[model samples]
Target: MKILVYGAGAVGGYIGAHLIENGLDVTFLARGGHLKNIVDKGLNIVLSNQEKIVHPSYATDSLATLKNVKFDVVIVAVKAWQVRESATEILPYTSSSTLMISVQNGIDSPYELNDVFEARQIIPSVFRGICLVSEPGVVSVPSQCSWTLGEFQKNPTRAINSLLKPLIGSKLQLKVSIDEDIIKDLWKKLALIAPMSGVGALTRSVLGVCLEIKELRNMIEKAVEEIIVVAKSQNIILPDETLENSMGFYRALPYSATSSMQRDIEQKKPSELEYQTGAIVKLGKSNNVQVPVNSFIYYSLLPQELAARSDLR
Candidate 1:
């Protein structure tokens, strides 16, 4: 099956490198220095133990170059905010049978893609792992990577399995599973990430430091509760134990671990703040759910986020 990894950043780059290593037909759509490095030096994946470099079947920044190629699977690995634009850009290369996978941080990506493609053609996925682009053309995987993908409206399980079958048990340390209800999985992950990232960015600290302080830890717990309430407003009932379970998951993470959004905010780069934390605030307002903790987190971080995107007025 021909696959196109649309945004070859940390997540996309890591997944594409593994697919290429296994001799699959994959093309990467990337831009700027990352694109140049991949074209010249190939894609490099750094694991905990060893490093592997594999050249993709094709990699290009120009969509016109592949105008005639119809991709079977298009993995939309871009940031949450970039999903809609990315979907429009890749539309010319997608046929009715194309499966567009949404593997972004927030819950809005699949819906965003639905504006461009049929809901039946979209697979909502959640990526769980510690991976990042250490440098141009290079991706680092410090922990195991797993994906939970689910169908929306139509059952594309057979097609989805066929597309991901190759990477299932490879030495890439990757895991793949299909969930019956992926929206709940997405909210569960958001409950953990949105609060952690929002609090981490505001404090400019790691997970350990954030949890060490009593006030910050309390805020994080309340933030998770806020998200749960918002999800319930949409009729997605998260487990009653979500708050405690999320805290336990956070505690198990490496002390130095930081969310990608937190790191981006620290570096003054554009982040998923608007899509992750801010999305909860918007949902709460629309649904009449009180999310003071998330509201403080979002509004407090707004100026910096606007500044990072060069819209700080």
Candidate 2:
């Protein structure tokens, strides 16, 4: 099947590399030095034990270059804030049969896609992995990665099956699952990540440091509670044990582990603050739920976020 991996950064590049390694037809849409590196020397994927390099069927920074080609599946792996713009750019290359996968961190990317594409064409997914781009065109996967996919609404099962078929038997130690209730999966991830990321950014520390301090740990707990209430306000009732489960997940992580959002903020790059922690505050207000903890976290980090985005003036 023909697939296009847009925003071929760490996540997209890693997935694209795997697909190409399995002999599937794949194209990559990336830009800047990363694009140059891939086009010149193929994409590199560094695993725990070894490294693999796979060149895609095609790689281009401009969609205009692929104007005549139609893609069967388009994986939207851009930042949460870049989803809508990416959707608009890729729309002309998709036909009625195209399946667009939303693999961003927040709960809003699918809705953002809905504005440009039909709901049936969108598959919302949650991705879990410890991966990053160590340099141009090189992705590092320190551990196994997994994806949980679910439809925004009822879609043709055959089409979904076709998309999953190539990924099933790969030697790449990747796990993929289909969830009947994907919304719950999205909220569960948000509950864990938003609090962890916000608190980590505020303190400029890793997950272990935040959890080790009494005051910061309490702040993290409160932030998680605030997200739970906000999720319920939207009629997406998370499990009663969400708080405990989230804490357990946090504790299990390596002490030095940091989130993508935290890393971006530390690098003074644009982050998903608005879509993750900030989304909680906005959703809570709209649903008449109180989320003071998240509000404080959001506002506390807004200055740095703005500065990074160059909107601080």
Could you tell me which residue pairs clash in candidate 2? Answer: none
Model 1: per-residue Cα lDDT at residue 190: 96
Q: TM-score of each candidate?
A: 0.94, 0.94
Please identify model 2 stretches exceeding 4 Å from their true place.
Answer: 156-159, 169-171
Residue pairs whose backbone atoms clash in candidate 1: none
Model 2, position 103: C-alpha lDDT score: 90
Give the RMSD in angstroms, all C-alphas superposed, for model 2.
Answer: 1.8
Q: Which digits, one per residue and each the tens of the lDDT, describe model 2 over residues 27-107?
A: 998989999999999998898889888899899988898758888889999999999988999999999878899999989
RMSD of 1: 1.9
